[model samples]
Structure formats: C-alpha cells, structure tokens
Target chain A: MGIIVLKGYMIFTIVLMIVYAVRHLLFAYNRAFGKQKLYYNDIYSSRMPKISVLVPMHNEEQVLHYVLDSLLQCDYDRDRLEIIPINDNSTDRTRELLDEYHAKYEFIRPLHRDCPDRGKPAGLNDAMAVATGDIIIVFDADYRPATDMLKQLAIAFADPSVGAVMGRVIPYNANRNMLTRLINLERSGGYQVDQQARYNMGLIPQYGGTVGGFRKDLLLKMGGFNPAVLAEDTELTFRLFTNGWKVIYANSAECYEETPETWEVRGRQIRRWSRGHNNVMFRYFLRVLVTKHMNWKEKLDGILLLLVYAVPFLLAVGQLDAIALFFLHEMDILSGWWVLLFIGAYCSFGNFAPFYEIGSALTMDGIKNEVYLLPLIMYNFYFYMWTISLGFLDAIADLITGRQVVWAKTKRFTK
Target chain B: MASDHKRQIYFARTYRHLKANRAECALFLLLFILPCLVLLLLFYDELTWVMTNGAVWMIQQAGGPRAEISAGTFLPRLGPAYYAVLPTTQPDYSLILGNLAVCLGTVWVLSTGPRKGRPVAVYLSIMLLIHTMACAFFLLGKDLMPYTLEDFSDLYIKQQIGIWITFLVLIGLVMGVLGRGAILRRMLTVVSIMLYSFVLGFVRYVLFLWILYRFSVLYMPLMFFALGPFFDFLYFVAIYAISTNGVIRIYNTKKKGDWVWA
Candidate 1:
C-alpha cells in the first residue's frame, strides 16, 4: 500500500508540475516568440537564395502527384530551383509518376538510385552526392508543403552557420477523427512547446526525419544520410551540431504528411522510429558531445535528445512489477521506486512544458477540449506502445552486432 | 464639532454593520480553541469516556461495531486481499434522509453566502469533510477507542494513535479558518478540503492493492478510476433527485407558493 501510494503520489506530482507549466510558461508563447516582428519587406528580401528540393521515393504510387503539384507551386525562383526525385527499387508505378512529372517540368529531375533502395537515407545520399544547389531541402512522398516553405527555410539559413533548418510535419487530414485530432494535438504540443522551448533554451532541436533543409556543403561534409541508422535525418542533424554546426527551426515552414491512424500501424511506426533514433544516438551522441568542438549547451541538449524515448518501456515494466509484488506482499519498497519517481517527474515537469501545445493548437484550430483527452493519451502511450524498450534494444544490438538500422521512407497522404 | 461628531457616528455605523452576522468567523475561532477546551475542561476519565463514546458512535454508524471478538473470528473472514466494491447495505430511508439533509444544508449555506464562489466552496468543503470523516472513521473504528471500546488486540495501538491525530487535524481543518475574512476563509476551506483529499490519495493505494491482490495489472485501471462512467451515472441520479425534491422546494418557498404537493 505504501509503495503504491508512493507511486501514485509521485505520478500526482508530475501531474501538478504539468499543470503549473500550462498555467505559467504557456499562457503567452506568442509574447515570447511572437511573430518575430519582422516587416513585410524584410520577409521577401531579394537576397533569399533558391533552395534545392530532394525527395527520395519508393513504392509511393498512390500519392506522388499531389506532392509533385504542391512542390511545383514552390514560392521561390523557378529557374534557380532543382527538384531531384530519386527512385529506389519501386515495384509499383512510382517510376512512371516520376517520369510523367519529369516530362512535364524541367525542374523535376528523375534519377534512378535503385541498386540500394535500402532506405530513404541511402537514396538521399546517392542523389545528394550528385546534387548541384546551394541549399538542400528534403521532403517525403505524400508531402504537401506550403507554397512559401522555401522562403521560410531560406531566411533561416541566411545566418550562415545554420547547418540545417527543420520544419513542422502535421497530419494532412487533421479533422479525420478523434484519434487523428489527438495525434494532431500531440504533434502540436511536441512542436510548439517541447521543440520550440528547446530552440529558445539554445538546445539542439530534434529534426523530424522529414521536410528538413540543410546546407548542401555542410550536409556532405558531415556525411549526409549515413544509412547506418533508420532515422538518418535526425542522426545527421545532431551530428552537425556536435561538429560546431547550428540548426534553425522554421515553424511556419510546414509539410503536411500522413499520420498512422490505427494502433497497429502507429505502433509499428513508433517502434521503427524508436529503434532507429536510439541506434543513431548510440552511434555518435556521446562521442560528439565530448568532442573538443562542441559547446556545453549542445552537449547537454544531445543527452536530453537521447534520453527522450526511454520512459515508455521503463514505465510499463516498473508499473507491472510494482503491481505484482505489491499484491504478492514481498518486494522491497526500493524495488519499484523508479516507476513512482518517473510518474512524479513527468507529471511535474509536464506542467511547465508545452507538452499539450499541439493539442492546444488544434483546439485553437477549433478542435476544442483536445487538452482534456489525457486519459486517452495515457492509455495509448502506456498500454499500446513500448517504444523505449524497442529503442534500447535496437541501440545495444546495433552497437554490438553492427547491424545497420534500415532507413524507411515515410509515405505521404496527398493522393 | 458637529461635523466631526457626525463623521465618527457614520464610521461606527459602518463598523457595526460589518461586524454583524459572522457565523463563519465564530466557527473559525471555535475550531481551534474548542478542541483544546474539550481536552482541558473534562477530567481524564470523562475525557476518555467522551473520546470512546464518539468512536463508538462512529463504529455503530459504520455498521462494524464488534464486541469482544477473538482473533480467530477476524482474519479468517475478509478472506484474501482483493479490490471489491462490497454492496452498500444501509437502509434506503437513512441514505435518502442523510443525503437530503446534506443537500439542504449545502443549499442553505450557498443561498446565504455573500460572495460569488462561496456557494461552490461550501458545497465542495462539505463533500470533502464527509469523505475524510468517513475514511478516518473506518480506519480507526477498530482502534482501542473503538477496538478496546469493543475488543481487539493491544497491537496497533500506536497506529490508532496516529489515526487519531489525522482525525483531529481533519476536524480542525474542515471547521477551521483557511484564509483571512469570513467568506474568503470559507472558500479557502472548501478548496483546502478538495486539495487535501487529493494529497492523501489513499483511495488509489487501497484500490490498486486490491487489484494486485485479486486480479491483475491489466484490470487495474478498469477496476480503479473507471469510475468516470459510474460518477457520471451518479451525477445524473443526483441531478434528478435535486431537481425533483430540493430545488423545487427552494423555488416554491422563494416564490411564496405551495412548496410541497405532498
């Protein structure tokens, strides 16, 4: 009873902390990072460089056209732009779509990188190696990027030291269902509160594995898409930071993509991502952090980024064990203390953080009470997916066995 | 001189008006001072008798006032540990009456309240007081005051003492002033009750232990806070009752009409 109470108490603490965050830190994010106060003329400066768009696709026969159309409407200089569509071992009519787009547009350069369709990272590397542009922008198939996304990203890179600029990926069909709405909210909170907070705190912002821009030279210099891990994009961006490179976040520059709607699909996707990113971090996070070039701020952020996904596994197991021993009447109080402590921690810390910002944003988008669906979030997070365990195991195995975490191209939802 | 005298008279009038009708204020002072007075004024034997009588009353109310029972008779029953909602066996009349009185008391407090949030505070404070009182009564009902007042072992005496302390603290807090002034203090009292209930969180502990002892972790949430549906159902019934009986009575009385068809 004491142990269970202690855990319940700790978790309750976390709940309080999260409540505090909601009350204090998030009331006025607009005030803190509010719309940058930039003048209209300042936004459309002629000095904005043309960005090269790179999208590597395989077996995305269903929704490639909408993506291409959205890309074709790029709000940058059409003549200076390049869109390299790398085809890698598609058994579907994906190659046909690329060729059809190629015939229609001069900027759509269809390239076959099929010998190793191992993943998007390999295709990106193969295409990126031969790309001829000042700035490299990567997008996933089924992506419907905002027209002015190029301008938003290009403005961020004017800082010169910015190695990459990561954009937001929201579910294309946000108003689909209760589940999708919840997912949109989660994404908002992560992007708006978590990532945005990290950005403000001078920490390394996590680059989602899609719709990110990189300095062409800097990307290759840091070894573009090492294909050694599944989340090659995150791997490279973090690596760039470790080597004295900085990333600029372009929140307004968004690419709408498909989110896994069902639990089965969502679980598998999360598992793969967890495994891949953990592999990526284990490979270089520590070494880069300790490196002579990296700053303390970046190093600390790197560790936080690494520690991000370990809780689900820890929480699930700890909760189950505590439940068992507490009933069996034998386990020591110290045995299940971490689980309690973790609950206490997240609930507390979450209060100050914008963990629910995305959901809040969707609410702002007229999706009300999305914030109150915490029980649903808990149900899905704890019961359905154990992403952290998958992450840890993958990292260790990749370390010991030297197995490459395969890069999986995310399919978009435009069609 | 006449002007100064008139001004002083006005000030005195305002002060007197402010001082009038402060039931909450009187209650606040008494909560702290009365318990100690009770302990000090009564002789030791009388005090013990008083304490035992109160415990006995609580035990009897709880329907578990055992008398001179052997250890063999206790643990053998209640069987294995399990989280079960044993049926509520109180008579329907008592439940309805107690519930009515509680509701009427709440309504009276709220209706007479001066501040905007005072009514809600009063309602919440009463609910919390009932909940905490029920908990303390049950846990300590088998103690020396009630246990030896009935018959249990000499063991668990210290725990009973601890339980007694929690009860006294709860009593003082529930009835005590939470903040400055009467209405704010009352509001604070209500908030404090809900806050304290949350902090205690023993309900969760007991339920989880029951789940672990009986079923499995898979059913833990279902067995526990799955009260969302049940609470909603209760709220519906409570609404029906309030609307049918109390609200109608209050409305009729205020309107100067036949308050009760019955």
Candidate 2:
C-alpha cells in the first residue's frame, strides 16, 4: 500500500516535471527558432503615453538615490510623466531621502505609508490608487533603468491588447561573486529567452514587478495587488491573462538591478518567491484551467508557469523516491529498457530549472562564455530542492492552517 | 480588409493541405491501431500477475504479508525478487482503469485535431505502440529475470553517458553543416533543441510511468495525472510537428518565401 502511494506520487512528480520542462523548452524553441519574432522590433513612434513610474522602497536608504537618479535621467517627456515613490514605514533615512528627491525633482511625488501592513504589494496598491498616468510602471529601489527603457515599455501599449509590459533585468553587480554570477545566468535565461519565447508563442510573459508596467485601470479592476502574497508579480501575471489581457515581454527595454551578493540573501529571496508563488498556484491553478478567456495553449503555459516553484520540491521528492526505491531493491525498476526513460526524465528534470534554458539565453545575449558554467547548476538544483521544498512545506502549512505569513523582505546590499 | 483577405487565403491554403494529408493520416493510424490493440490485450494478463504478486512483495517489504511499517515513516525494505521485471501484489483496478482512460483519452484528443492534425494523432499512436511493445518485450522476454542493483546502475549510467556523447556529436555535426553560418543562431537552435528533446524524453517517461503503474498499483494516483498528458506529449512530438511544418511550408510556398526545410 505504501509502495503504491509512493509510486503514485512519483508518477505525479514526473508528469508535472515533464509539463514544466516541455513548457520551458517550447518557450526557448519559439524564442530561438520560431520565425515570428515577438518583441524584436524597435519601431515605436513619437506618440508616447502618459506614464506613472512607481518606485517602491522600504528602508532603502542605501540604494534609493541611484534608482531615483536614473528615473530623473529618463528620456520621456517631463510633462507627461509622474514618478511616485512609496515610502513604506522606513525608519532609516529613506523617507528623508525621498523627501529630498521630491523637493529636487518636479516629477517625484513620495507617498509615506506610516501605518502597518507594509510590503511591496501594499506599497504598489497605495501608489496605484493615485497614479494619474495611462500606464503604470514599477521599479524596485535597486533598479537603474536605461533612459530609453520607459519608451520601449510604453511603445508596447500602442497595441490595445497589451495589458502589461515587462523589461529584461540585468544584474549590475553580477561580477561581484559566484552567487551573483549564477543569478545573472538565471535572470538572463528568465528574461531574454523564457519570457521572450512565451511572448513569441502568444503565451504568458511574466510581469516581474520590477521594470514592468501595466494598465493602471486593469490592475485596479483586478482588486489591486494581494498584499499577503510574496510574488505579487506572478499573481498579477495570471490575473492579467485570465482577464483577457496580454503581458508583452519588452526584451529591448533592459534595466540594471542589484542581485543578492551572498547565498544567504539569495536563499531568503528564493524562499519568499516560492512562498508567494505557491500561494498564487493554490489560488489560480483551477481558475487558470477554467478561465473562459484563455485558450488551451495559454492555460497550459500558465499552469506550467504556476508550477515553476513546485518543480524543485517535486525533484527533491523524486530524489527521496529514488533512495526509497534503492533500499527496497526496487531500483532495478529504472534499469535496462527503462534506463533511457529514467535518464530522459532526469535530464528533463534538470532542464526544468537550468542548463539548456540558461545556455540558450546566454547564447542569444551574445555571452556564450558563461555557457561553460552550466554544470554549476547541478549544485544550484540541489540548493533549490532544499530551500524550495522547505518553502513548499511552509506554503502548504499556511494554506491548510489558514495561517497568515508576514511578508519577509529580501535584504539588500550596498555595493 | 487586406489583412482579412490574406487570412482567408491562408485558411484556404491550409484547408487544401489538410485535404491532401487525409489518406496519409488514415494509413498511419491504421498501421499502429491494430498493434496497440493487441498490446493492450497482452498487457491484461501481465498487469494482473504484477498486481497480485507485487502487493505481496510490498507487504513483504513492509515487514511481512501481515506486517506494517511504522505509520509515520516510509520503512524501506528489499523484497527477495527486487530485481525482477515485474514487482507488486494485489489486483489494482485503478491501473486497468487508468490505461483505459489513457487509450481512450488519447484517441479522443487526436480525433479532435484540425483536419491536418488527425494524421499526426495517428503518428503519435504509432510512438505509443512502440513504447508499449518495448515494455511488453521487457516483461515477457525472460520471465522473472533478476540482477544486482549495482550492476544495473552501472549499465544505466554508462548508457546515459553514451547518449550525452551522441548528443554532443549531433550538435557538432549541426555546427559543421552550418559552417560559419550565423554562429549565434545555430548555437541557440542547438541549445533549444537539446532542451526541447529532454522535455520530449520526459514525456516519453510519463507514458512509461503509465505502463509501469499497470503492474504495480503502489502509485495509482500518479497514473491518474499522467493519463491524458501521455497522449498529449505523444501527439505533440509525433504528429503536431509534422502538420504544423506542413502548413507553414504550404503557406511559405504560396508567399514565395524561402523554402528553408528544417
């Protein structure tokens, strides 16, 4: 009976892994080989939309100035643009710095949330309430947007179908350490290839809260942002899609942001993301399937995207099953003719997170040298299995017990 | 109006292509359907034996026919014939049900495809038939064949390593074919194909799991989720690609576009 149950779970894990792997592979393929290049054009006319840039900061005194300064240098029309900086209960000099910026720049309007329930989603919700622009753009405290980035993002709105537009995020201090380097590869694959391919395939291109813009009214209609969820970006992506709106991946609208400088910081960030994303998955998995607006392809992609955080947990379970099977002397079940199938599934399992996806992204970005570091992802996979599995447990506990989780922030480093 | 007209023309062209491929689709579907049906029949007896015996094996592993491991933890135990092709005991109706569902669900999905897609579905049935035969051959080839876990593991590892080497060689050949032609483009294509192939392989594993669960009811729930998708993947790799490329080629020809055959 225990064996039967375990076998069932193993099958469940392998199937999900296959779906996840296939989705990423399809996206990568469409981005690489699909003739119709989505977001490949830089043909934005002089007709720019009214843009409201929301910079969400929480005790971000270390890096607020850099982002604000970058925004100040943006090439968009000054009269048409408005910058709202959300100062969410910052005890440090963050509010004071925002005040300084507000005084100095005519466009910088700082919102101070002195009350409780302070996180990025909450900040975004408050900022969205008063955002006067036609298009609402978001930037994290550490992001340094290129002058033309706003224009590139705004241009996508020219097509009425585009509910949101996301730009590529390049890590500024990527060369600082090995952790940052690995993060850079991940970010590159995620944005340059994965997101791009999804866009090309007419599938879900994630609106990664930072360096992404969306229709203010659409978000407002979707009941603003869910403050309880950690990955507000992923939640918003699904919401947008299910609501008959599209999120465009503006790969050319590249912006530089700080990645975690250490493993501790990276681990915390991944955990929070996993917690938030899994929460969204529990909420949206069925909704995505039954959503009237989405086609089968979109639904498949959305569900696969929702399961992204769950893959590591599944892989970890697969590892445990392997051990259990080994001790039970049932490991031979994966031998002989089954070896090809097992190895194939195993390869697909790794591809679920790294290697070929990252390699393709790097190759597309003209940074083929980093392809050699692809093997390091084996270690990264194990790390993800550990952290993400723990996060999955926490998510499950929170979901089942109706326990509210405090939104833990990703600690920033000053470089 | 121009865009609408172009779309209409494209649809007309696509219709013609599908019309042309109907015979091929029928022929392909017919080729595999008989074998698959036979394989299904053969699977019945094997599945029954595995369920009854594998349950006993499981019971033995747990401690004995009447023994149970501590409820909280999964107590891993080795049965006497752990290396045998089929392992399990007790008749699992779920495996039989799941297989029935997969076979029917796959046929239904394939049948629902565009005119051009029906043939592709037939092609996928062929792949599934191949997978079925492989599983059947393994089970019936040598009754209750046993081996050491280490020896099996070594063989598996070596075989996988060889596959990787073969994959590298294929990529190298692709590069040679390109011969200084769009280096970045070719490299990205290779990477994408490699990743996509892994996904395809995983889908194949999913189907294998469906087949595996037939003899072992231990993981019946896994088979449930694996059902419709096994067919979906089989269809995707076998038939979907061909029909899509065919339509694209026909359209490209109509537009006098580059006849770049992939």
Q: Note the DockQ of each predicted structure.
A: 0.03, 0.03
Per DockQ, the best of the predicted structures is 2
Candidate 1 docking band: incorrect
TM-score per model (chain B): 0.20, 0.31
TM-score of chain A of 1: 0.83
Write the residue-wise lDDT of candidate 1 on A162-200 in tens digits: 788787777877677665765776676566445554565
How well is each residue in A221-247 modelled by candidate 2, as lDDT tens digits? 889988788888998888888889888
Q: Write the per-residue lDDT of candidate 2 for residues B43-162, one digit (tens) a residue.
A: 423432343344435534644333211111011231211112333332344544555456556656655645212223443553343333323333343223232222332332223222
lDDT of 2 at B53: 43
Assess the local accuracy of residue A351 in candidate 2 as a C-alpha lDDT between 0 and 100: 30
Query: Per-residue lDDT of B6-93 in model 1, one digit per residue for the tens?
Result: 5532111000101122365456547543554344333323322333344334344555433221121111222211111221222233
> Lowest summed lDDT over 10 consecutive residues: which window, candidate 2 chain B?
B11-20
Most accurate candidate by TM-score: 2
**Candidate 2 TM-score restricted to chain A:** 0.94
